[model samples]
Target: MKFKVMAFLVAMAAAVPAFAQQAGPTTDLAKLEGGVFTVDKGHAKILFSYSHFGYSTSYGLFTDFDAKLTFDPKAPTSSTLEATINLDGIETMVAKLNEHLKTPDFFDTAKFPSASFKSTKITVISPTTGTVTGDLTLHGVTKPVTLDVTFNGGGTNMAKKYDLGFNATGHVKRSDFGLGAYVPMVGDDIALTISAEFNRVQ
Candidate 1:
């Protein structure tokens, strides 16, 4: 019986490499065909960082948002993109601070409940990296901003659907958006990073 058990273990070990090479659920962006994709918000986030009185870099996230990607892998330059963010979903993990952010001094959700970005141009740097120039509308102001974006990967979800992932980073001055309440104290320079997943839509 012991000999049988030892043989079984060896057989399993021999088969491991074959199983490892079997196709798994990873998306290759280059292979993706042209189509429209929408954000899987459950797997997406917009993270922001700013200096707080020079004490530390405070972080926050917009909890609710939607994004779309129009991709033509063969001709990426023709692709366009758009995203809408709900200011009401802003969360800094601190209740008081979160409340203040939604008020007139900051986001003023009452006046502009949402912000949006619509890409005007896409500069492809390679198969997996590019620059996205778009109009970012925030606090009733619109400005041209560029984001350095990278295609992280593509994969299937629990539902077994094709999806793509990406990460992007950019910077903008809050004062330019008319949200200049704190200025130097709160840090006008805001850095942002986004991790987003988009599932193809018919």
Candidate 2:
């Protein structure tokens, strides 16, 4: 009887880790309702890079962008994101460069005040990783893009608020959307990077 008791205790001890693992990370949203979350714009960044002179890379950022995340982390595949970026808010170190970027030769901010993205599908690739396939609209042209996304981490903030972190990346072609005015001078591919923080609404 003592031997059987010892065996049962050992089995119970071994089951502890498995139970904790099943509990998963504390922020598992799948068990919760998918509600609206506000993007912490102050902690959000939308940056892009393009080849300069076919040799070097130049980077720029949009100072104004808004995003809404409707997420259920436990069921990552059901998550969706909608984001809008003001093209007129593109900022660069050089004032003249920023001005030129908004002209018809580039973004044509006068014609297209904003760019937007809406995810059509979200596929959970792993426990903390996923891909969002969506349509990105820029300068009146829409094209499909896939954002490789990963959940960074989330927890209660110092303000006693629940928050989430994410990083995503994708690429776009200038020519495909009719922003081909720069041609070989500015390189065709533009790399996009997004780092955003979201605060739970409730």
Candidate 3:
């Protein structure tokens, strides 16, 4: 009876590593092949929030944007991220407020149709988290910005395509981007959160 119990324990121990391996990253970026992934617009968006005169916070999102990502599971430190959001895509639940956001005092969409970010450096904080430093161009003004990024995972989908997801947060000053409207009233600091997804481009 003791021999049988020992045999059962050994079998269970051998299966533990297999279970963990099965639960690992779906795409295993370290071994990701094919090509760069393209933003799955239907599932990607930037959600932003800012203080509203110490009363409460306001939230909004950009309706149109695109992103590109390259991740290396083995050497995540070398990965890169870039995104471009249309200045005219702001939605704040109020039509007038949304239009106001695109005016000369804010994004000035007519002159700067879009905002872009291109990473210059990447620091790996862990296998699934890291810091990305890049230049953000908005309203014709360019400044350095850093984002904390985390890998959500990736894998083959029902369509036989690879999909990857990540979440990122960063802070930026509106005044620095030429968006200095109602500065102290609306708060100058913008907290940006991005829930983005990319699919292997075929």
Among all candidates shown, the one with the greatest TM-score: 1
Full ranking by TM-score:
1, 3, 2
Residue-wise lDDT of candidate 1 within 92-166, one digit each (tens)?
A: 999999999999988999999999999999998876788999999999999999999998766555566767788
lDDT of 2 by residue, 6-25 (tens): 99999999988765654222
Q: Pick the candidate with the highest lDDT.
A: 1
Between prediction 1 and prediction 3, the one with superior lDDT is 1
Scored by lDDT, model 2 comes in at: 0.84
RMSD of each: 3.9, 10.4, 8.1
Model 3: per-residue lDDT, tens digit, 1-202? Answer: 9999999999999988866654434535555554578899988879889999989999999999888877665666676778899879899899998998888878888989999999889997776787889999988889999999887778765556678877899999999877878889989999999887789875
Model 2 residue 26 lDDT score:
42
Candidate order (lDDT): 1, 2, 3
Candidate 1: residue pairs that collide: 27-154, 27-155
Distance from true location, Cα of 28 in model 1, Å = 6.1
- Per-prediction TM-score: 0.86, 0.82, 0.83
